[model samples]
Target: MNKVLKQAIRAILPTWRTTPVDVMHRESGIPPVAQLLEARRIRFSARIKSLDPAHPLRPVLLPRKYASEPLPPLQTAAKKEAAEEFNAWLESVSPLTVIVYSDGSLSEKGAAGYGFTVHQNGRSLRQGAGRLGPAEVFDAEARGALEGLKAALRLPQSASQKIVVCLDNIAAARCLRGQPSDSSQGVFLAFQAPAKRHRQTDIRWIPGHSNIAGNEQADVLAKVGCTHPEPMNAAPTLAFLRRGAKRQCKDVARAWWNETAPDKYRSLNLDFPNCCPPELDLPRPVLHHLLAARNHHGDFADYHERFGHDDAKLTCSCSWRKSPTHLFYCRKVDSRHRMRLAPSPAVAIDRAIGRDFEKFVKLAQSSSFFEKICPCL
Candidate 1:
């Protein structure tokens, strides 16, 4: 099945048979058959997990699990509104009221971390930071909120005293307000116990990077946690694993192309996994001509001779061999049409195969331009 798919992709790219599979996959941005099947399986499993408890297929698909505790009350507001509300609430609260700020960070290298700061009135009381190793930012956010709540609970407070946990990630706040179904289920469950015991506890959302002091402090602490020497030995989330898989596939393909791609193809210097190139949106025949020119595989004397097309013309009307580079210098093509594409021959060829598509599409679709260059067309 993948072989058929590969043939179809080659036809679309209009590349030569000698083109490496890695190059084809890199240019097309289509994963192999196995990767696609694995992605489908992951999606199916997630669907099963989202089904209702009473669903008949739920038990058949997955083993029965204990029900999660009800989530704490959540308060959310728009960015500007949230900042204003939070500031007003801070001014009105007593010195005894506990306010906790939490944040999460993910590094470019995929390390994840969480940070929290617990405060009373305007004074900082406690702060915590930790590494979650190979985890998603979502997990880090939930864990940070959980740690902040735990620190707030440890502080001495009356039964009626208000405890508010503030975070910038609204999705994490909403998840804590609902059932726990993601990879961070254990952390959410742990948070539920203390929150349920304290009736005055509430989770609140605030806009991140809005110049809030506590949020900024928490953000710094999270970055610090990312540089920690040791990481927590926690199981990676399903989402994290899925992302890693796709990234690995692309990395392997890129490495293969860099090490073994033909010199002619390598000279183009195209990036691997060139997903959604603007040229793909052009009309089909125009796209075909553009790709053929880029790959050096269309209506050229060398290509025809290699494929044993004896009847095809070997040279242009100007008596020069029809080749990819000849399109730039062929005097048989009208100089006006050539200059419309580019002022210089080098720039014209670069624009034809480069990332910019606007000029290339115009030149390719221009009446009689390709026909003048290659009479065989």
Candidate 2:
């Protein structure tokens, strides 16, 4: 067995970096690497003592008891036994009544999408999706959890019901389980909406791509929701569970702006939009002035909050706005109106545009509003 292990290690060396001694010990259980090499039992130049499990080189060296146990010497074999032991322990305690899997994703930076599937007795109970915009990854994960619970609520209730929510994301499960940070606003609010219903959920972590059935399905749905660029209904699936079905106080004006405004402002590509007005409508003349300040890099006689003009050559940074040039340079009445308006309106407009843009991006990323915005390039 030792000689066979040496040959296996040499053959495996082309693919892996493990030492022959390490391979032999991992393969042949009885004599161990050191004893086999000391007895001229294996082919290797290094001293037998160097191959000792007690040597400082190996971190995964098994204890004497580990070798004595009726187990294979390979670390993989040991881990399999440990996993079986753990599975036995869990089965003894709870018996795993249900497995729920959930996932969250974002198409753009601000949008969030999530999906979940619930299973028990080898059957699916429910699954769902939530779409919104301008939320972070943490927020998306929370949405997955909250939305997952909502899906589970569609099933029959029982006192012995034990649900295991397998999450593709660690942050989300950790956040919900109180292992790390708190859940995000979308998730927190989603959880609150359905809290009265799904009272028996247990959050759990599972390694992705390990053939977890429900987890893979949930992942596929999450990908679809995240990658799909079309606009959606923008309703959280858990909303029906909320008391009186009262919706969160969303700013409709912000939503409208995001739906209509160009991507340059909403996507944070430039600083000029952030400086736009928020509450009040901006006049046409001042809009041009701010656009000019942003694009042409010009100076003004007085730097109004919106307009930064460089009058020496009369250039500014308004790259998107349509200008006939005479609008700013003309000594006409309209150009005078452009210069005389209160700076407050322009300031308010710029700020509002910025805020609305951010909110739009966030909400659009949700599973509900998956719309793609083609900015005016």
Candidate 3:
């Protein structure tokens, strides 16, 4: 539409339910335009009110993030002597010490789940798992680490005993180290923050599936937690927030397209605005000019008259009014130049727009068709 004319219609209508009218009466500032716009707005508003209400778009929330250190490499092989020493260190830990192993699992449906096992002197002290709702693997991994660290920090261990939380996911371990990488920030906010206050707690990363009993137990619990039937805490991670935002935008856009697209535009009709349908993917200007010649804003006597080129007379070289009506009915141009239209001139113009749009799409299928006939492509 012409910007000024659209604004005039908007000014009269309450903006919620205004529909496009036959804008051949293009006097945007005139009283007739306001009257026409009000009538159309009322009709469109009633129609929309009668239809089912559009589904609501949901909003997403996200956790706060802090500037943390860069991440470390996730997994490294343990050499023969080092592996033995690491196993020995685990074996020789004080009986009063608290140690935890955590893991995360992502379901086929992308549900986030976390699990942890707390042990004292190589015996199970407590074990639990929880779901993080819809989330990515890394975010779930971080959540598991936070939960394990949280558990380890609060345990009834001796004051002299060391507190250690281990996890196979290197990314989550880095988050525990206070590095905020993409979506793991939520874990820090919801669980890791409290654990951070207790400085005695230490986080360790070990190679996954290294025959470590605690780590294997955590891995199983993580998988089980993901498909748990009960509702779990759905803390908004950065990844979940991003997904929600993208979905909301797409839904709103689709709804708007459905609501405002021209009623005459059928399933296959492309939107050909201003003589060029970018969606048509055409390669030449011939069809563009050809299509525009049938509209009110065309390079015809009616369009020229409206812009004060003549004395508002729309009569053409064929001695007929060269308005949109004449384009469909005019015999002087070509006997075969026919356009699909209704009996009413206004409706004919509206309906023809969709019909021509579809025609243009079909014409555009052959990329080199225009290039063969017309040198300028």
Candidate 4:
């Protein structure tokens, strides 16, 4: 096509959604001229050569035609066809609609590249590309969807309208339906603002390549987004790294405190602050160990008097066994279990370590001094 023709097409296509194609074609009246040019080319006539003056007639812009006049209701095969056609034409003119489709590409690192494509309709409106970081395939899919949606919304569209994002990735679709992507913070926020104002505002997922125009375009767009530079952020990848670093720091702290802290540090003489009630006994091993450590230094007869007899045994008034199990398991005395009866040698150490780590976490979270001391984390 000539430059004039290309420019004209761009100008008129933006109105195709609301305008009837028959009306548009009649208004454009370019078919006869196009046919005439085709005839001239077929004949290889001398007149065709002569028509090319220093400047030929400026090309007439043609409005787009909807594939079907009466759109079928949405269901069944016919409705599907109509929906596909309607969406195709709408994409051509709506300008706000961006479709992205994605498939995974695998590598030896147990990694996958999300193959993607972006399109407005049959026309390739724009493209994007990206590479997955250390995330699962589903995570990659969600990231791609989020990226594509962001790209579309950032385009020059009417401000009143929210962009419709179509994707072929089922995992991505599920993720969007379930939870917003933490990585796509900007896009997630962008979508959230309109959600408060409108009930129908949302990104949509269509089946892949089911002859669906938007889905096909999305597939192309996703591929482009995959290869293109990631959307702007101060440290998009760094957020993940920071999160990982935080977890590693916590693990290291816990391990070190367990290995080095004394039994007293683990069983800090407190009454299980910030823990479940003592009545619940909710696996509060550290609290139990702490109680045991404090009580273990006292008289065994006192421990027995507090929690020695089972309720059932007491009710029956029977002589039960006098083993450590009788004091701990049978009597359900946590102090007895923590102080003496636990078979694992590591249990006491673990309790001691946990108590110290808990204190450290609290102090670190609250104290400016602690923050300065461990700036590496």
The candidate that achieves the highest TM-score relative to the unseen native structure? 1
3 versus 4: better TM-score goes to: 3
Tens digit of per-residue lDDT, candidate 3, span 1-377: 35676666555432122123432221122223344355455555433333323532332333555546644444445544445555777988877778888898888887778898998888987788988766777777777777776666666643456778888777677667655665765556665555556645677777677778888999999998898763546555656666655454344433444454444333324332322233235333543433343333454464565567654445545466554334455454333444445486555554444454444334323323223322211
Residue 164 shift from truth in candidate 4, angstroms: 1.1
**Candidate 1, which segments miss by more than 4 Å at Cα?**
10-26, 31-96, 108-110, 231-239, 274-278, 308-321, 326-359, 365-368, 371-376
Q: Please report, in order, the local distance difference test score of every candidate based on alpha carbons.
A: 0.72, 0.45, 0.57, 0.41
User: How does model 3 score by TM-score?
Assistant: 0.43
Best by lDDT: 1
TM-scores of all predicted structures: 0.74, 0.35, 0.43, 0.31
List the candidate numbers ranked by lDDT, top first.
1, 3, 2, 4
Candidate 3: regions farther than 4 A off: 1-85, 158-160, 190-192, 230-236, 241-377
For model 4, the run of ten residues with the poorest summed lDDT: 368-377
**Candidate order (TM-score):** 1, 3, 2, 4
lDDT of 2 at 39: 31
Question: 2 or 3, which is superior by TM-score?
Answer: 3
Q: How many backbone clashes does candidate 4 have?
A: 24
lDDT score for residue 308 of model 2: 40
Across 141-188, the per-residue lDDT of candidate 1 in tens digits comes to: 899999999888888753667888889887888766556645677787
TM-score of 4: 0.31
